[model samples]
Target chain A: GQQVMQIPQYQHVQEGEDFTTYCNSSTTLSNIQWYKQRPGGHPVFLIQLVKSGEVKKQKRLTFQFGEAKKNSSLHITATQTTDVGTYFCAEGGSWGKLQFGAGTQVVVTP
Target chain B: GAGVSQTPSNKVTEKGKYVELRCDPISGHTALYWYRQSLGQGPEFLIYFQGTGAADDSGLPNDRFFAVRPEGSVSTLKIQRTERGDSAVYLCASRIQGASTGELFFGEGSRLTVL
Candidate 1:
């Protein structure tokens, strides 16, 4: 079984501040997908990184995959109240099974 | 439907009861997945279906849980003799064929509560 570990199980950020969450795997990963779940809501797809050392941006959110493909990071710049949610990183298995990380719950305060 | 749809957004039953949750994936999608998520935790893989066949069910916790996608469209997850531990949010997701690494479209999920 493959698993991903996320750091800073809980994150409290000030409005307009920037923060980063990391996801690491003990084994190499083929692809990594990021998701966000708002309070009392279902998880929604954010982005997916497949290439090594790849980086993608969505508005103020930046997603990066490690050169070794064993780690990934999601950084939110100038966080807003809309950024309040739990961010999850998942590994896309060969047969379409997605194993998700415990997630980093972010809370932004004004 | 435009996105995945799940029925009975919430379910509540006593222990030892039988329950069934249904998932309707996006039309034309060939892959469907079931996951369970407890409060404050991420989604845990449960089963995956490729068309009308169960591609990978190794994630199922035990025999009490079973799922089917007979016509390669709608899927139903059944649980017999449920326990309080079985309480969680049952999430269903779908992915188009050949997009193994693509993002998954998820349903709002069915929250199960066992008393």
Candidate 2:
């Protein structure tokens, strides 16, 4: 059974603070995807990392893929109240199957 | 429809009852997936359909859980003799042919409560 381990299952951050969550896979992955799910909402695709050592930024959020493509991380700079949600990292496999991590729940207080 | 559509949105059933959850993926999308999310957990894969055929169903928990995509557009997840542990949000997502990018457009999900 393949597993993706995520650290800091829960994180409560003050507004203007930073937050980061890391994900590691037990097996090599072809690519990884990040998703955000607001409380009481469905998951939404955020970004996907395919290349090794790849890094991508979306406004205040930064995503990084390890050189081996076996790990990834997401960092939010100067977190805001709107950033409250669960962040999930998923390893994409063949046939549209996505193995998702348990996810990191982020709570930002003003 | 503009996005994936799920029926009922919420279902409350008694233990041992049979239940059927439906998913209507985005039009023109060739890939559809079913997942279950328990409290405080991420979505777990249940099954994936590539067009009219199920390309992978290894994620299905047991024989009690079954799904079908007969026409490659709409799918139905059937649960027989449901139990309390079956309570969870069943999510459906669609993508363009399961491309390498792996971007998925998801529905709001059907929350199933087994009492």
Candidate 3:
């Protein structure tokens, strides 16, 4: 069985501060996908990292895949009010089914 | 369709009753999936359908929960003997081929409340 755990269950930060969330899994993953769920909305896929020790960037957001593919991280260079949401990491395994992480709720204030 | 669509955005039922949630995946997408999201938690996988057959259903919580995709496009998740713990948001998503790419377009989800 594969399970993913995310850190900092909740966080509150200033609009200009930086924030990051970590996701660790008990089993090796084929790929790790990140998602963001806004208030009252479904989770939206943000990025996917496949290769080990891979790092990808999307504007101000940075995503990293660990060397062992057992962990991943999402970092925002400078958080904004629009970044207020729960960040989720979904680990897709060999079965083609995805097991989602508990999610890290981020709240950015002005 | 432009995107995934789910009917009955919300459902309320009494204990022991049965409920059905419907999901219409994106057109030309061969893979459909059902997931449940409890309050303040991430979405949990319920089942994955590749074409008309269920490729993976290990995520289903119990035998009481069943799903069917007879048409290979729209799916229905049926829950029997609903209980309070069954209350959650039922989400539906679809991929191009149940594999890589397309980002898995999702619907707004059907929020179920069992009393």
Candidate 4:
């Protein structure tokens, strides 16, 4: 079975601080996508990385795809309370099946 | 522009009861997926439908679960003789065809509680 691992299962940070969550896959991936889910809410699409070693930024958040397409990371700068949620990284396979990670939970307190 | 919509936001039933969860994906989107999320866990893939056909259903938990997408649009997830362990949130998502990212637009989800 293929597995995707995410570290720092939980993180509590103060407003204006920074936060980072890492995701790694046991096998090579065709691509990766990031999603966020608020507490008790549905998951929302954030961004997707296709090219190896690709980095994309959206406002204060930055996402990176590993050069080998086997890992990814999401970094937030000056986190805000609105940034609190569980972040999941999904790996796309050759069959087009998407494998999701366990996700990292982040809590931002003002 | 409507997003994915699921009927019966919450369902509470006893063990051995049968239940049906419905999903209405966005207009013109040809790809739809269903995922289940347990408490303190990320969403797990249940099945995916491409057009009117189920492209992959490897994630279905057991024979008690079934789904259908007859028109290539809306879908229905049917569960028979539900068990207490079946309590969880069922999420539906949709995306456009030939999408490079395949970034899914999700519905609020249907929460099933088998008591």
lDDT by residue (B1-115, candidate 2, tens digit) is 8999998699999999999999999999999999999998889999999899988999999999999999989999999999999999999999998365779999999999999
| Model 4 residue A79 lDDT score | 95
Residues forming the 10-long window of minimal summed lDDT in candidate 1 chain B = B95-104
Deviation from native of the Cα of residue A54 in model 4, angstroms:
0.5
Tens-place lDDT per residue, model 3, A2-106, is: 399999899898998998899998777789989999999999999989999999999989999999998999999788899999999998764456788889999
Q: If you superpose only chain B onto the true chain B, what TM-score does each candidate give?
A: 0.97, 0.97, 0.95, 0.97
**Which ranges of candidate 3 are over 4 A from the true structure?**
B98-102
For every model in order, the fraction of real contacts preserved is 0.86, 0.94, 0.64, 0.72
* C-alpha lDDT (0 to 100) for residue A89 of candidate 4: 88
To one decimal place, how large is model 4's interface RMSD in Å?
A: 1.5
For A16-71, candidate 2 gives per-residue lDDT tens digits of 99889999986788899999999999999999999999999999999999998889
Q: Tens digit of lDDT per residue, candidate 1, span A42-75? A: 9999999999999999999999999999999999
Off by over 4 Å in 2: B98-100
DockQ of model 1, rounded to 2 decimals? 0.83
Clash-forming residue pairs, model 4: none
Which tens-of-lDDT digit does each residue in B1-115 have in candidate 4?
4889998999999999999999999999988999898998878888999999988899999999999999999999999999999999999998887877778889999999999
Residue A66 deviation, candidate 4, in Å? 1.3
Model with the higher lDDT, candidate 2 or 3: 2
TM-score of 3: 0.96
lDDT of 4 at B111: 98
Compared with the true structure, the alpha-carbon lDDT of candidate 3 equals 0.89
Candidate 4 chain B least-lDDT 10 residues: B95-104
